[model samples]
Target: MAYKPPTRAGATVYVWSNYSLQERDRRWKAVRESGAKAGFDCIFVPLGDGIDARYLTQLRCSSVVLPTDGRPPIIIADRSSSNTWAPEPWQTSREWSEPMAEALLELGMERARIGVAGLKGGRVSHVTSIDGVVNHGAFAAVMRRLPNARFEEATDILGFARYIKSAEEIASMRKAVEIAEAGLAELAAAARSGVDAAALYARVMARMLELGAEYFPWALTLGMSDGSDAKRFTDPPLGRRLKANSLAQTEMIAVFGTQIAEEDQAVLLGPIPEAWKPVVARQREIFDEGVKLLTPGRSCAELLEFSKSVAEKGGMKAKVRLVGRGAGDDGPVIGAMTQPDALKELTVEKNTLWLWRPTVTGADGKTRFTWGGTVLVTEKDGELLSKRAHGAISVA
Candidate 1:
């Protein structure tokens, strides 16, 4: 019997999860190198969405014990369904702790130095979290079981490795950008005085998933504010509809397979007040100038400072966070507010993906503007992946 690929109503669709074995090896090589450099014999990963778990084992929806010796990771899936998603010849279980410790012991790693992921905030710059996201019960269980093993913080082993995009990762990110643009286009076309903002968001989500977004990100940030308040994003009160003069915006993230791309979406429901036009224009100018600095080797601090100075000179305050990593797990999220010392010293690297959402608020504070896109840092320069904004989607 032949396995026929699934299709939707006689239409052609591209499968977005294709990554070559070599690409997988390339990622593994990075993890191995990072571990070896850190003197880690194994890395203990707990339950997470498709993060390092996906990068190393492809079955990280559960937990993983990745031996630094190039051996396949030992997995404990959150559900039995994970078994279907992982490649063959590997085993999965719903149990944790006992099974996990057993794998390390079997590998003669009970006394080996192990790196514990989620121990502290190393994924999105150690600045974002004073303490990393870790499951204490899981850690305690292992501590009790593997009494002789040593543990150390190992988040960077995966963080730095994920920062560099492989050829396949870039392709998937591009596709995610395409899917996001498709949704943005639909949202723009759907925007009008009478539509419900929530309804509009529903449409956007449907379209993205139809085009192959992995799932509906439940925590999507979207909002609509009517005149004078200048609130960029908010859920409309029940039964309220978009007024003729309104601003609808979203902090959108589109996921394709494990890759992601993000953008700031805005739709103007009516004409801007005469006084606000120049302020908006100046905001756009700041964005235009700031984005050019996305090239590799550019300093994150320098870019943020440039944005602040330009925005201030142009009559607005630059957003505290200018950009965020936009790939699997979306880490190293930088901003002055969270971790200033480290963010200011970071450098943008080639092939690193990002979502640049540069925003500014006018002197009155209510007159705000945002123009953003997902871009890839290339050897030559920053390549824009999203093509949805020419400022904001205007209905008037």
Candidate 2:
């Protein structure tokens, strides 16, 4: 259903999310000091990736702002003929642009200042259009509708707003971390000689679902390293089998509600190699050192430099994939896979979530070892979210 934009005298901000209605409400509250009531005249909900009319309806019904005449802000959404669910009378099933134009015109906002999602550095996923596509068409359509309207990219507004986690968001992330730990435990238990990558992946996925995980960002990636002088990683779990006396490297992410927890583990199918022991120890040390520095107000650049120092002191070359990243919604990524200077300006803040991953290249150059888990930044220190031990899990 569509409504004319309100005659309210504040700028309208359009945004979307894959999170629940309650989470979206919290985000809206963060976006404006007056909260949802005076934040904007309307919100544009996108239809895609499990977001449907029912979900939008719930958002509208629950997002009532009592201070403002007890009326909720107008919610606009689009529907297509291909939508499997029946459209609510209050929702617009027309191609997204048409309804957006109507709403703007009705609100007498044909020539007003507006903030669209992804105007800055935010993600387009926050503003998907009909047909589940996020592209220039939606923005172009709105431009056509309100030619005189001044549009601005408001990406960082939402990014910084979501930087700190609410108590509810933290709780969801904690549960998500627990679920990920369970999945890792399952992987460790099932990792052994003669087991194929696919089988191990299946086992962990089943356990995660059984433990109430709703969704996962990516499939489990499992590979084998035989202490050879060669870099190795694998494609999606195929039929590759774990060999005796080899290390099984596994990466998995588990989700609860929309929060995510990531775990990367190395399991030894047999005896650990003498050559690999020092490599593993140094990787652990680097991770520990980095974790200790995850205190509030610490610059990501500082932490990265410290991490590099730790690796250098151990006579290893650091190939940092991710020092960490914002964990809840669209990530305000930190660190670098290639450039060390990336995200140097962003500092750690309390109540923020991150995945601290550090990888080190051995003296041999070809051998690389890596490991880490999700962490929550507190006022004093960063709390490790995953329950598993940091080093390689040895399964004899």
Candidate 3:
């Protein structure tokens, strides 16, 4: 998909997350409806852990509380902040207490039903560290300030709506994927040509940012290991060499604006062993087949069962965490890795995005030869959003 520039009809554009004001209005309205369904008068998006608020306000870092009555929302931010393409329909406060409480009272929400995001949404929403991303002090102070108001943990108010990705969200994700693959290509080239582990990892990040990426969020691995053990190094890759019989791999998470795209690449340090050839081919088939099943209207239970069935036939481990897990900012919002039951009820919806990595392990359970890329769910099937070659790269 090609990237489209968002337009505002002669309005002051707030350099927000590449979304138009009309899109913002569409999202807030959706949140308002979601809140109404939850019997809440408003939804509170807290500081530091307020992804939902950022989703609503489109501000860089959002402290937003949305009301269901169509009244203006509340935002807390640094007054000195500049060059922000902030929203128009919201009021602001300096912090989440005192002034925040006053704003709530003035809006006639002093004793109203307020839904708090991230309170307990660890299992369901983008509320991660997934256990409670809300700040206790900020929420507690507001509780003391509005003792009469009823505040409930309501991550779903936003979670439900977030699962349904808009067209604009998909476009941003495509851009993020573009940025990630550019960096991944660099790593692949450097690996074959003999690059230092530290220098290789550093260069991949540098390349991604140079290509207009917002952040290189987390995760990196560059080590020569003979087995399937994903050796996570705390020490820098100072002397790690990309020599024979070893692998240099990384599951890169590249960011563009608020969207993230992930892809795993491994450069083989030696020739392919004879015993691993069949396993590699079979896993590739399984991965390609499975991606097609990631279609709209498919139940999670059905997909889980499908993976399990194929894993049995192919002698692969049907691990949920490793096989398929997602619905990131672009899809599957209620995926609780701890709770499998919720996933059973999750129906695959269009425009949801996830990281699907299918690995082929040999007898030693180490040597995983496979491919991974961010998949975008469409009406027909899963779309691999990467331009990288679809298999493990082996160098003589």
- What lDDT does the true structure give each of the candidates? 0.66, 0.56, 0.66
Model 1: lDDT equals 0.66
Worst 10 residues of 1 by lDDT: 1-10
Task: For candidate 1, give the lDDT of residue 154.
Answer: 88
| Candidate 1 to truth, TM | 0.85
TM of each candidate vs. truth: 0.85, 0.76, 0.85
Once model 1 is optimally superposed onto the true structure by TM-score, how far is the C-alpha of residue 246 displaced, in angstroms? 1.8
For residues 115-185, write the lDDT of model 3, one tens digit per residue: 88767743336534456677778778988988899988887777767766678778887888898888877
Q: What C-alpha RMSD separates each model from the true structure? A: 6.3, 7.4, 6.7
Off by over 4 Å in 2: 1-25, 34-71, 77-94, 123-133, 217-223, 227-236, 321-329, 336-345
Q: Which lDDT tens digits does candidate 1 get at residues 81-145?
A: 23323443123443456655666676678789998776777645333555666667766787887
Residue-level lDDT of model 2, residues 288-377, one tens digit each, is 777788889987667666655555645677654443333333444444432444454678889888877777767776556778788889
Candidate 1's displacement at residue 366, Å, is: 2.0
